[model samples]
Target chain A: MSAVAQAPGPARFCLVLLRRQLTLAVRRPIEIGNPLLFFAMVVALFPLGLGPAPDQLAGFAPGILWIIALLSNLLTSDTVFRSDFEDGSLEQLLLAPQPLFLSVLAYIGAHWLLTGLLLALVSPVFALMLNLSAPAVGVLVASLLLGTAVLSLVGGIGAALTVGLKRGGMLISLLILPFYMPVLIFGSAAVRNAVLGIPATPYLAIIAAMLCLAIALAPLAIAAGLRISVDA
Target chain B: MWSFFHKLGSPPWLYRIAGTILRWLLPVTIVALCVGVTWGLLYTAPDFRQGNSYRIIYIHVPAAAVALAGYYVMAIAGAVSLIWKMKMADVAMKSCAPIGAALTFIALVTGSIWGKPTWGTWWVWDARITSMLILLFLYLGVVALYEAYDNKEAAGKACAVLTLVGMVNIPIIYKSVDWWYSLHQPASIKMTGDTTIDPSMLYPLLLMIASFYALFTCCLLMNMRAEILEREARTGWVKKLALGYRS
Candidate 1:
């Protein structure tokens, strides 16, 4: 949708945005590292609280993992748009020769680069600590991969909506947590099924369906939120 | 009609209308509710299976019905505000949030109460009940989002957008019970003419529905009036009305 006429293709847009975010993360390792560490810490805490018994930890693994996922995803949401918002970069990004929506999309796409895939990659390390079985680990990794992309998308809307407010972190959580129920339900359920050695495929399919819906819907909602923020 | 619509949008006009109606309607609402509730409970024969506990339907059904309708009121108000840029529409939408929330809570609590008597448990993830609970969360989310922002108008718009987005939950809540009918047990009391429910139970239930509607209109008008008065207090007409207060 950019007017540059360099090449009107989806690949260029996705790759460019994705690469930009990744490059930014590579430049600032701490930004990427902090949320992931928080996630791992949260996951590790549950087993300690429950004691060292593998069976005890294993039984609660799905709930523990998903809750950690929720909190860290929430923690990451706070930083998603605030820096650009305060620094006037958001304006530059919006006023880019490209479509404003694309830039917003790019910003969140970059966010997923650091948060989603990275979280997925590191989940296995913590998954073992929680004593999650191999199959359940697979579902946990996949759910974060898909679900946090949805979260980033949804949180982008919340961030944009509340960008101008002081202390929006708590408010954003309140607004988004209820909406995140399906993700929590399906994600944890999928992992539980995998733990049981059930097919787990149906649950995965539903997560996929939810992700597709969010991918389709959330950007438009975020864009609308940005417009409202602009109006005020 | 145009003049009537214009006058209704005016706070002073609304206050007068609401005041006049409140004087009569409040008593009528209480009387109707008392009659509806009394007849539904005492006159109607108890269910063969659910028995006297089935009487819970009198409160439960009306609250559920009103809560569902209350959401539509809020949504339509949101839509109007978004499209027409009407300040009063924003007020109506904002006011509807808390009222709808309370009614939804009532529905949920009464459902749980009814469940204890019939289902032998305090809770089940029944489709209808879950949907109603979702409705409550959606209502709370809207109210929370609106109050969260530093800027009032922006908060209104943000909440308006959220309400429209969350309206999907409404239909989901409604049909969820029906869609998962196999998984979710069917409704015990049917509204339509059927072999099961006796007529004595039905009339008072209908009265409660009417009372709930009247109550909603009464509270909604009161809220909208307060909003109009607060927002318009600085205006010339509002000063004239405010200064004219006799007592």
Candidate 2:
């Protein structure tokens, strides 16, 4: 879709923005990989500290993985608009004729694809390393896939709000982690249910509902936040 | 009627009115608090099972109730600020964070103290306590966001947005904490449900909760008065007020 570089239509603009974000992210392999590495290192620390008891490790794996994923996503989101904001591109985007809501969606979409999707993809390896049972791995990956998208969307609100601030690194976490708790709760619960051979669909359904709510609402907040941050 | 609404926008009017209201309301709040605390602490019958330790309920329940109510107050002030661009509402919203955080902290401390005597532990990640902890974080988050911005107006707008977002999430957070607790722990202790206790105990609790609400209002007005003075210090009215106070 982005290959067709015609007149800058709204759809084309969004596509271009998404493609630009992905391309920029791809160029910075280290930035893209930091969260994954954080994920792995934190997961590795668990076994070292908690002992190699498989049952205990497996029980905590779902919560540990979900929490680390939440943290990594939170960390990555703080930079979502930081560079654009600093370079004055964010102001241009704000001044553009395009709807800010759509542009914000594209930014958040690109972020989710880069950090959340990648995190979900690599979560199975972490799941195995943590000695999670085989059946729960599917639920683990599925929950992350859905849940991390919500984190990125919700986290985008905090990112947009703090993007203009000098010391947003720590403040973004405080602003967004309260919003992340429900996602973390349901995500891990789904996997725990899976590990126990119980029904996980209900928890997954709640997570999907959360994703839908975030998708419908978060961009509006993100747009408002960006406006405020830019004005600041 | 609408003149009163218009008057709310004027800082000096709000300051004067808040001062007048506080002059009456503050003493009433203090007296009510003393009466409620005394009634609950001494005049009421103790819990059949937990003895005098259960008396912590008076402070704990009111603090927790008022803390939860304080979020609504904060969020509603935030909404008013955002919707109407009311400077006074922004002042009210900003003033609310520290008071709410302090109340939430009191709730948490009292809950922990009560837990030590009842549950035999100083802390438990009980659903209510965990929710209170999250609420404290939410309050502190607003305060932090406000302080982080150099531009005061932008800080108010940003905090308003964040508060609105937190408002939407509060119910979900409460539900999830409840569900999480139910799944992980057996229902070892039942918190005060509706109408379970005798009227003797419940009366003092109701009085305490009512007084706590009054206390919250008094604190909110006092804080807003302070904020208005701080913001308007350079203005003519505030300068006159300051000279008058000094003289």
Candidate 3:
């Protein structure tokens, strides 16, 4: 029983971290909703700018949605470490006894849950509005589910790297957006494949592979970046 | 052997050695570059298909190759700095970015020129060219990140992590873009591989490639020397060097 109790230590720490992050996010509802709002507004602008031609909008829908999702994720990710760093919680996290890696994961997981997951959930409405085919909507959601996790993970690295900078607003995007290109390419490709009546499984699998890679490697970078920022 | 690495960590030793290497390397690079360019331009026969436009390969291919290789050099230096906390490695890593960016820019411009003549467009989103462009952005990102931070030490560590991350992504980006390009269009630039070039053309191309590498080394060393001097401006060796210049 004691061994069982001790074994959940890492899990418990991660949960507490996740809960803390989510609670903080909940307290600031506007911040939590900003990415989704951006997603919707950007999605709306496409139709307005490109015209009401349903076929043209539908043809562009996958790329458009994926690009907007990428942007929202990029923008929100800048704040992931900012508040903590500014308030000195990041310093405490660095000096804490538990592994910084798991805590960093929990922070990034909360970010994804708040921003990317919400974006994926709301993407279908925009997808339908953009006239994306019904079959492709599921692929869009799945791609976002996997792709945004990768984005949050990768973007967390950029955020951690730039958190110490005073004017990191635009720099984080410049740093991480190129990294987002692959996710965008594969995610949109998956949706496009589904729209064309082809199998999107391969692209989704690649995204999954990317997610696995990010999960295994990105926290180390986040941990390193956090330490560097804290030291700064 | 271990002592040599420890010596490498010393800024003055590195500064002096880099100067010695540049003394011999710079002239060799310039002479080879001139010879290679003259040979490539005047000596090689025009392509039956591309005509004179094909001569740009001597510049384009070498620039692209060196640009890609420079990223690895920068990343390796970043890794060294991160792992060993070697300040000279940080200097080397910092110096590599702008030079790499410049080379990548050259590759893109020359490729664009080559494209206008061969493909009748300034750009076509070809796989190699697209990847090279991304490489330029990656270099610029590192430079921007380094400059954004007020703390130089922390900036070094951050840039190190970013460069390592970029290094891991380069192969994936290259492959994905290659796949993307192939899917969208047939192989457009077949001037190099579809048909083998004669020895007459290949020789100067090889020389140009070698000289370009030497050029990269020279530029990298010179950049590192300048960076070291600036970074150690208040140090004794630099102060003495500055006084000597003044005297």
Candidate 4:
């Protein structure tokens, strides 16, 4: 009762929510593994479809890697708020003293950590599988690290909007995929520039700018979406 | 002003006002469109470089410009609905989607047709064209999102948030795509070079663009009138209107 009477500050609430999400995600190791597995399988499939020629694969490697990263992030984002909404914890969070803006960011932050963070870490292996140059592999990872965070944040808007729907899986893609284009464009451009032995810093800077913008703005939409979805 | 705004919130008043405006504006828009098209296509001199093919600009440019502007209209309407909880703004936003999508489709198709004559292909990965394609996708996404929700009120709100998000992203998308295109292709065929247009060609093009805006308004009002009727079917005013009662 005393703890309930003295509510935590917004920052503390966000950290608590972040920890809770990570702990829940960590409990289900398969969930964390699924996007990575998806990424690897897709990367392997591209070689078959586009021909197994090393140079060709290497030529297209940057785009192929960034696209797979975006898709994997898309797949995981739908579940960020689904379980909480299904279990009514989302409602509790809505009723909490803290503003939903920070709370929503915490959810997206945990999501980025689990999916985007891990994918960027392992992408160099996939980059090599596609015969991407060693210099470009570093840029691929850096771009994905920055780019997928924006994807996760934007995807959170779709996830929150459709979290209450029975058939939100396919619809979520239709809703948010357009918003994902800028990130994909800049992210892949950065890697492509590195592959061509040109400076990739400008593309990376643009992506970083997009990430900053998304971090500031996306949660407002996500929080509003959650409210509308829950209310409906 | 406040009274007018308050009156604007009344569905019956808006429906009647939209109908009244459409009664005069629709014919004017159609006539203006026909005049602009004929003048641009027949009266204007053939371009020295492209001949008659360049005249497609009358349709292509106007559609593309209005298609882009319609998004801002939708976003602003969405913002009004979100902030003011104005149901009319929701209807306005909802109505903008299909009109905007159709205009975007026109722009893309006309651009493709024009490209065949000028660029020697049906399409090119030019930045503006690609951005227009993405704009079409964005409009369709909004329409799809709106239809997916079972509850119409919530659907309006959800689509509103999506539009606002897209509004923020549109500039970034355009900039990034522009940079990406410039990086990949170095100064290929410019869509429109800096050559000064003759006033003879420019006047009709300006007229077409103006008429396109008028066309957009007409379509929006008609769509809104239908939406208001469907939504307000149970209201006495709508019932009276349907029964042909003037009052």
Candidate 5:
């Protein structure tokens, strides 16, 4: 498809908007806090629901952590375009001389910085509370760091695609979940395998590969989807 | 270039062409599905080990196979429509999504049912089944995204982008069986392997696969026609077509 053929200096464009998005994210600490809060609350719920047995708690720790990570990612995914789209801010940016794909990537990058990194960093205290081993905590944090960035990038595709739709949250999950399966499967599996004292190298490698592919592919798709949604 | 754009933008012409395809595809699908499923269920005997439950392969294999293939087609169609500005392609993509979702649902339900008798469990987190569940979610996402917007074009593009991005997972879904600790059997339709089961089971599966492909074509055509008709009804071409005017 000529979708990529018309791309205009993707590198410079990506950086220009990437800086802008990063600046915007830094300006809004509260925005990043929501998912972090969601992640904490979700992880905390497990102990309340099932009384904390250190051994029992440790067994369920990896899965609960990953599922919360997915949900928090999902919660933030809906915002990919809602504010800019509603305020006509996105239109102003699109009207800027900046390349469209760069703008799209910037949006995705800010989303990653805002939600993904924050989620990874905030996970440690939760890990300590959950009785997860230090090694398990390391695996959980590392995977979320890698996996959530991938999630934000990919989830941004769903958000961008559905930016113009009214009931976008539900649709975003629909579009995002399939792409997320392997990441979730390999990602959580990695942590679980680690907790079980097995080598998680293979699963981590899969998550890294998934992140690479999603980083390469999703930006273009999101840009294209944004253009079409905006045009309509 | 202008002519191509004009033709592509023409709703009536697309609807008419899709209608023509639908007329023939329906009968062909019905006939093919009937024969294939009959041969699979009645003629094909049970496996020596799996017994009668192996018959579930008649629906399970075909549904799962078509579900994957259908996603590629649907997503690619979404990409084409969004990129090339083809209205017919968008219609085809939208129509196929729900059908694909239904097929995925069929695959999951039948897989679980088959598992109950074979594996003695209602569900397993094996790679294959999990991936299939994810595929169903993908379909749901496309269909939901498509229906979310009031704007036809926006929905199409959104769903299209989602589809293309989601295509990255299809390979994993295919290989999940080999990758995970699943209870499901390996591929029955492999191109270059020694036969795992006897010739009797394989042939029926082949028939079912073929029939499912044919049925898929018919359903896809029907859905496309319906979508095109709904979208194009306000246009002049649709008016003429509705009136049955040739010229």
Candidate 6:
């Protein structure tokens, strides 16, 4: 009874929320595997569509890989708040003592862990399959690592805004894809620079800067969006 | 000042004020647009390098300028609406979206028309052009999100949040031509440096730019007036106005 009376601090609540999200995702293993399968299938299609030319595939691989990563992130973002919202836990979270800002970040952090982290980890295999140069593979992974965090954050804003709408899947892309452009531009540029033997740090640095900006700002928007969605 | 802001929140007061302002400003805007267009198209001397094809700058530059500025106006109004719960600002922000989108479309189309004669292509993925296209998407996104929601009030708040998120793109669009090496020319009218354009061309461009700003204001107020009426259709004053118009 005493334990129930003592509310967790914001940080503690966020950790608990994050762990709950990860455990929920872990139980549904198919959710973890869908984006990766989508990535591989799309990578296969590029070679078939553009022809079986190795040189062409290798040349286009950096852009191709980055675009697929972005699309996958976009697809998964719509589901971030979806199940919670459907189950009404989202309202409980909103009414909790912890700041919604940190709570929203916890949701986004879990999303990044499930989607972006796994995508970044497995991107090198897809990069090699597309014949992307060995040196650029590291940059591709690194760029996706930094870039997808920003994507997930931005995507959280869209998901939060549209979580109450019935047909939110298509509309979510329209709402947030423009916000995704900078990440796409710098992410692909970093990998492309690596392919050409140029210093990719500047591009990666710019993405890192964008990540900082998104981290600081996106949660506020998400919290507002969630409030509005819940109220509506 | 507080009373004035209080008055702004009243829908009937805003509707009447917007109508009054639009009556005079709309005519002046039309006149200035005509003079500016004629002055640009007929009075200005041809460019030595590109000949008359360069005249499209009169429309292209001003539209792009105002379209960029309109996003800030929308975002600021959104901020006001969000911060103070101002319904008039919500109307203003909502109104800005279609106007900004139309202006952005004009900028892109005029740019493409100019491109065909100057760059010898209908389009290129140049930095400035791409950024402007993204600006159009941002505006349309607000409109789409607004229409998607079942509740109008929630729609306004959602769009406010979205606009604030998309506001980061504005500075990037402004700096794209400078930041990237592209076929698009840099700004000729400098605030603190020598103006590159001739005075004859500069004067009409200035007039056009001013007219475009006025045009934006007129359109925004008119849009707000319409939105105000639609939103307030259930109110007593609106019904009174409707009956008064009939009699």
In angstroms, give how far residue A115 of model 2 lies from its true place: 0.7
- Give the DockQ-based CAPRI class for model 3: high
Where does model 5 exceed 4 Å of error? A1-28, B1-14, B173-195, B244-247
- Cα lDDT of model 3 by residue, A105-196, tens digit: 99999999999899999899999999999999999999999999999999999999989888998999889888888888889989999999
Give the runs in model 6 whose Cα sits over 4 Å from its true position: A1-5, B172-195, B245-247
Q: Write the per-residue lDDT of candidate 6 for residues B96-120, one digit (tens) a residue.
A: 9999999999999998998887778
Highest DockQ: give the candidate number: 2
Scored by TM against the true chain B, the candidates give 0.87, 0.96, 0.96, 0.98, 0.85, 0.91
lDDT of 4 by residue, B1-247 (tens): 9999998899988988898999999999999999999999999999999999999999999999999999999999999999999999999999999999999999999999999989899999999999999999999989988998999999999999999998998998898789778878888687786778899999999999999999999999999999999999998998898899996
Candidate 5: which pairs clash? A174-B141
How well does candidate 3 reproduce the true complex, by DockQ? Answer: 0.80
lDDT, candidate 5, equals: 0.78
What does the interface RMSD come to for each candidate? Answer: 2.9, 0.4, 0.7, 0.8, 2.0, 2.0
| Highest lDDT model number | 4
For A173-211, candidate 5 gives per-residue lDDT tens digits of 767776766677677788887777888887888889878
lDDT of 1 by residue, B2-36 (tens): 78877756666677777888889888998998888
Using TM-score as the yardstick, the better of models 2 and 6 is: 2
lDDT of 6: 0.90
**TM-score for predicted model 5 compared with the true structure:** 0.87
In order, the first chain's TM-score in every candidate is 0.89, 0.96, 0.96, 0.97, 0.88, 0.97
Q: Work out the iRMS of candidate 3.
A: 0.7
* Residue B75 in candidate 1, Cα distance off native in Å: 2.1
lDDT order of candidates, best first? 4, 2, 3, 6, 5, 1
TM-score of each: 0.85, 0.97, 0.97, 0.98, 0.87, 0.95
lDDT of 2: 0.92
Deviating ranges (above 4 Å) for candidate 4: A1-5
